[model samples]
Target chain A: MFDTQSANFDVQGLSVALIQAELGRREGGIPIGSALISPLDPDVGTEEVPASGRIYIHGHGRNQRLQKSSAILHAEMDALEKAGRLAPEVYKKATMFTTLRFASYVHKCMCTGAILLYGIPRVVIGENTNFKGEEDLLRSRGVEVVVLDNQRCKELMREFIRYHPEEWDEDVGGSKETSARAS
Target chain B: MFDTQSANFDVQGLSVALIQAELGRREGGIPIGSALISPLDPDVGTEEVPASGRIYIHGHGRNQRLQKSSAILHAEMDALEKAGRLAPEVYKKATMFTTLRFASYVHKCMCTGAILLYGIPRVVIGENTNFKGEEDLLRSRGVEVVVLDNQRCKELMREFIRYHPEEWDEDVGGSKETSARAS
Candidate 1:
């Protein structure tokens, strides 16, 4: 059901590029983005981030446009913002996914957006790459994780770069967040 | 949005008795049960359960059933059955959830059905009572869980036994598996 290539060894990665390619839509300059977050994710909990918390590559969307499959992730972002670890404003209307790698520009942007918004220096997946419970385990230590498998985690950095032009340049307000926003 | 008691620290648990009290009905001596499982949990891979892996109380459902406000907790049952861990017949007509304790009876039955049908000997919550990721952590080992907070985990062994009358009596066709069929 996860639409995996090999369900045994794979999961579909919710990459930023994939979102950019699949969900990043512009209707008369009004961009419609979708986000998903787990309610249980520690990153979205309204608690303090343990000073030494782990990271996971995250892709976020607005709650207004968040997907049902992504509730936990949306919540994760909520937690990140509620806690002083992340700036509150940028994520106020966002949805997100946490993976181990910054697979694409959109992915990087989302992660960057988290860093900028959360004010955290970085996002890191926990110590074990394949440990699926890393998010839950980390969330316990105040570490949140959203496990990504190869099927869901295809590398799509180029697609993200190819599709998103407005936010690519800093001088032209090419900020990832700015470019992602449509009028 | 999660139907939690207080956005600060609570989620409502759905149990069978509660469901019996809330949604169950005796229609010609046959009880009507409806369950909704999420589509994105890691346990039910739609392939094979990794042997010697992990267990999480998976409450999987078809993604087609997922909504923006809910995460993947609903689909835990489908995964278990699909993996052949649970007999096909058991879940073909059933659905499931991933919360540790059922606030309602129907929720518990579906989850309990998943365990009994899957051939798992028992459902063990990890040692840590407050660990949220125990389901994900345990599901990785092939066991699925629904984390129970103090309010919901009110030792429902009696309630579980009471509602599941057919499965409780080891002497009178009380097998958890034998008692689930409704005629």
Candidate 2:
């Protein structure tokens, strides 16, 4: 009952509709599912998105136009996709819902951008200036955001593996961590 | 408009409802959003799952209990969570869906498992033995299934980076290749 697609990509700002438009132009693939996934902020990225992108978390259902998703931790996942760091199918899946890909707003790539991890370990945090005002919201939730450059994210993951080393084992599907552990 | 939770975790197979019950027990988190994120085979992982977990993809909307979601790609994210490789919120977020954690089903700790990737670059493919009979279905899609072990995935990825070195840039999030290349 929730698989909705939009023919109206003309809507302003980011949404499943707009991202679908973005995906089609960039990847030559079509988005699946049902939903009118639109951006809560009709004027997002106007004066808000810093040059890099924002990684914010929100209850997408808390918004009006989306009910199919509960969150979109937007980071640079799309940039990761464009850079060939991931598959188009994976990127396409992230666009099916609204709240989760909000993290995609902050980055250099326009067609697709970044994504973030809310409550995920090995967070690559930097200046909250990129996140608009969501940093304060995150702080209110008692999350500790820190510096996460390539080096820092690597260090953080090293710390993570120290606690969960099996995440490095191949059969366990630890490749995700193996790939992300910053080597 | 589709949300169903079950106190009946005793069903014969995997379903989003059973996974939700399992998540609450393991992580003390509740899944959000509408849809029944379950396995296609009611009797999965019985004899079909090899010593390792399976990585299969499908139209999640194909089931009746799942009306809001379109897919779930189970992999290894759960092992990371059980090992505390991730933060609680991210783990909690994952409980909102299913897939990647499926490897968790094959390993030491198993409360609930599986996850779905949004959109990333390299997709690690292997056999679909865990998927019951969907191997033929996926074959029809013209996707090639290969044997992926630690060494093979490493070799293939190395070959990939050699051809697409731009993916190796530190800022690009190809840290997997970054670390492995050194090894």
Candidate 3:
């Protein structure tokens, strides 16, 4: 149902990412989303982009309860899995669009490792989260990284955190015993 | 068979983490590995730790080719998944031991998110990879983290990178076209 024929891949990809984030919120999951677009052929000419030349795969982060393995399912990982299944050959040429800015090494290593393994060439994120050399690392590895701020995507993440106060609480030291007792 | 009776939990946990890393290397996967030990009951007394008071679960990173969904499975995620299935009740009290030092946010966010969600209290890594505030984030969330360097674990990871040079190559720009042509 998406406009696959659009030459503006970024526009289409961001729209898909936003929709997926909203869907995740509605499904009681993390409000993070990713959209991966298969590479466009250089020989095809950029004027009239053919729908067949590109594939769109979108995914949203899932809560631990919704996962069969009870592991946190990340939006980028979900989209990457789907892309791998749908198109392995052109997957490496894919451009990934994500709704959140990564701020931790765990997320950077895991997702960057996958992106590099699959040879994804470009990544677009919604806003910056004080990225510290992560963008440089990606660039060094030949990944074109872009940060494009989106108001709606920011609002969705804010809402998700608002709803899940316990999960995001920073006063974790005082609550450790409480959590242990509750468990 | 591991000596689970050892009162030194760190020694036992590190040994398990190392073994898992070796297993991954032998299985043609990533050399990273993780071990999760369920918390010892507070009343059990630390001097003579009972076997029934704790549980150990270990896992290794898997290659994308080995996965049904083609997702790159991190050692931490693998261990977390197994712990969730084996013992959901006491999983919150788990202490995670990992063979590698994470250097990216992808790994940090994914692994940290799961740890927080499960209410895991402690984490131990083999070394530090110039972590930038990620450790602080974890500590702020009430997680205790320790870095204990190990020679064999470092050797295993080095060998993994040596064997898979293309995967870790920093000059990814020149190879993009070549990869596209080969595909």
Question: What is the DockQ for all candidates, taken in turn?
Answer: 0.01, 0.02, 0.16
Ranking by TM-score: 3, 2, 1
Best by TM-score: 3
Name model 3 segments beyond 4 Å from true: A1-7, A40-52, A56-70, A85-91, A104-109, A116-119, A129-142, A169-183, B1-33, B38-64, B67-69, B84-183
Cα lDDT of model 2 by residue, B1-183, tens digit: 122233332121134323433343233222211122222222233245322222222212111111211112112222222222222122221222232111112111111112212211112232222223222311232322222232322343344335544422222222343334322
Most accurate candidate by lDDT: 3
lDDT of 3 by residue, B1-183 (tens): 333455667767877878877877777766677877764442233254445644545343432323333343557767755544333234455678888755322222345555654567788887554233343556776778877878887787667666765443221212434223222
TM-score of 3: 0.55
lDDT of 2 at B20: 33
lDDT of 1 by residue, A150-173 (tens): 332222322333554532222112
Clashes of 2: 51
- How does chain A of candidate 3 score by TM-score against the true chain A? 0.68
For each of the candidates, what fraction of the native contacts does it recover?
0.00, 0.00, 0.18
Worst 10 residues of 1 chain B by lDDT: B63-72
List ranges where model 1 is wrong by over 4 Å.
A1-158, A161-183, B1-157, B161-183
Which candidate leads in DockQ? 3
Worst lDDT run of 10 residues, candidate 2 chain A, spans: A64-73
